[model samples]
Target: METRELRYFVAVAEELHFGRAAQRLGIAQPPLSRAIQQLERRLGVKLLERTNRTVTLTEAGSVLLREGRAALDAVDAAERRTRRAALAATGQPGLVLVTKAGASSELLSKLLDAYAAEPGAVTVDVHLCGIGEQERLLRDGRADVALLHRPFDSTVGFDTEDLRTEGQVAVLPAGHPLARRAGLRMDDVTALPDLPLPRWPGPDGTYPDGPGPQVRDHTQLLQLVGLGRAAAVLPDSCRAHLNADLAAVPVLDAPTVTTVIAWPPHSRSRALAGLVRAATLL
Candidate 1:
């Protein structure tokens, strides 16, 4: 049962001579012989056949020797691996964060600051990448964790946490007709004279900015409205951070874009949990 006993038994079993096995083990021949005797007695098996001039292994001794060597090798490997893991977790390691290239960059900046504020030796490496790249990195195990927008492909196998909700708002040109309305409903804006709401892509199937109003990236579409070129409705949160020149009205009747923190299924990491917690705080 003791590792020492196993070691002594194997030494003598392989060498078939206690004196030689003791030399190999850097121990006295008497102790090595006694260890083998105790091991065989505990197992209730005759392991060795000793003669005046020759020594030989019994059937049981041969089998135990083969399996004992394998057990010792496995124990050595497990100990080495455990030490390596301890070093990785507490010594020095970087937490990987992959995210979409939009507002997520701002969100990560805030999280990184919070995570770094903790005491002790800990730090993070942020990987700010495109939406497609973030998804790919998470899928391929290159990322330890990530923060992303929801309504992603379910097939990507991601989990999400709702960070914040940004509702629809309307942007209007500085001098455009209907600019005076406290808040123009989508229907009201449509009815205004030269409402100039960018024409959502018609059946031609292109996008509004792309050729669909729905598909316009925040920066470009917001630009058009910021210049007073047209009125736009976007998430209230996005508008909340905009320049004084641009204004947004909530579309009480429209769908809202909710920002969520997403990651692959079954993903578990302490650094990730901290980041997720920090994101909601901001």
Candidate 2:
């Protein structure tokens, strides 16, 4: 199917209402409906179930929606990468590296220093972003490489090198009784009735239903912990950055976090290769 038709169907599938999807696409409702119908005919499947007052995706529609989003993202990445290539051909060229803010601080610094010492090293722009934002940035070509922490970040569809693995710690209010403990299990922190764990945004940029305050980054979550409003479980390295108001205890049962340097599988840039090499060496 053509990109335009895929886009239209995706919009409709997501919004579940032709009127809203048409408005989102900045078009009239009738042509949008016609496009969906034509696409369904061409694909020989019922994409949507429409009623007088509601709209819903058919089994086929759900699969198309998932696949279409990936296809569109690939197209967008290709266009952006091509434009960047042209710019590199005629203008100052650089690399963009993205990672979650307040993560991998010491490792990132050492990696940067190591890469800078290499001969013919290009300027590397570092982007510190909110939770669940780095993967999307890398996927859409807005960033060249990323420092992804897994089980938190997915490394699918990319080439990655394992950097290091560390255990997790529970960050809590310093004055809380639990903060004085030698170590805690996952239940000790997760089931805290008073200091509910903070909810982080998912890949879809929506927070899961929870009782905790929605947080966007490590800094924000720490501030909340300091204020006795919430708690967080993060990589053990975070303990080094805790202040007087916040305390960290080893979460013995939490899964280990693995930091990986990731780039698109198709990348062949010498500078990117050098950066990844430096990271692995670190």
Candidate 3:
């Protein structure tokens, strides 16, 4: 389907009302409705169920909404990357590498230093983001490469090279009872009544139903731990950055986190390749 048709369908599916979707798209309702109808006819399936007062997605429409969003994102990213490429050709060349804030600092430092020493290295701009945002940045072409942790960050559509695999630790207030433990099991941490694990926002920036403080980044979570308001499970490497008010005890069974350098599969930029090479080398 055309990108215009996909956009019309996505807008309608999201709003569930042609009037609102048309308003959002800066078009008339009739044209929007007609476009969706033509799209459904060409695709040979009912994409939506429309009654007098409400509209809902059919199973096929649900699938298209998901796939259509990705397709549009890919198209947007391509346009952005192409424009950035032209800018690079005109002498503003650089690679933007993104990762979670306060994570893998030592590894990132070393990787930057190593890449800077390469023969034709360009400027590497490091973008420190909040939890689970690196994938989106990379996918949207705002970033050339990203340092992603597996099982926490999705790496489904990228080319990646595993960098470091480390165990996890439960971070708690220094004065908390669990802070004195030599190590902890997953159950021990999960069952803590006074220090529940902090809730992190998903990709949609909404926290799941939970009885923990909502947090956006490691800095906030660590501050919460320091204040004795919550607990957190993070990569063992985090121990190096812990302050005196907080403590990290190894969580014996927490799944290991593997840090990987990820980039789009379609990227052919030599500088991005150099950055990925530098990351894997470290």
- Model 1 lDDT tens row, 152-195: 32334567777766556676655555555566567876555544
User: Which wins on lDDT, candidate 1 or candidate 2?
Assistant: 2
Model 1 misplacement above 4 A:
1-92, 98-109, 119-137, 140-143, 151-156, 189-216, 228-231, 280-282
Score candidate 1 by lDDT. Answer: 0.64
Residue 196 alpha-carbon offset, candidate 2, angstroms: 1.2
Instruction: Sort by TM-score, best first.
Output: 3, 2, 1
User: How does each model score on lDDT?
Assistant: 0.64, 0.93, 0.93
Worst 10 residues of 3 by lDDT: 273-282
Candidate 3 off by > 4 Å: none
Model 1 residue 35 lDDT score = 82
Clash totals in order: 12, 0, 0
Better of 1 and 2 by TM-score: 2
Clashing pairs in 3: none
Q: What's model 2's TM-score?
A: 0.95
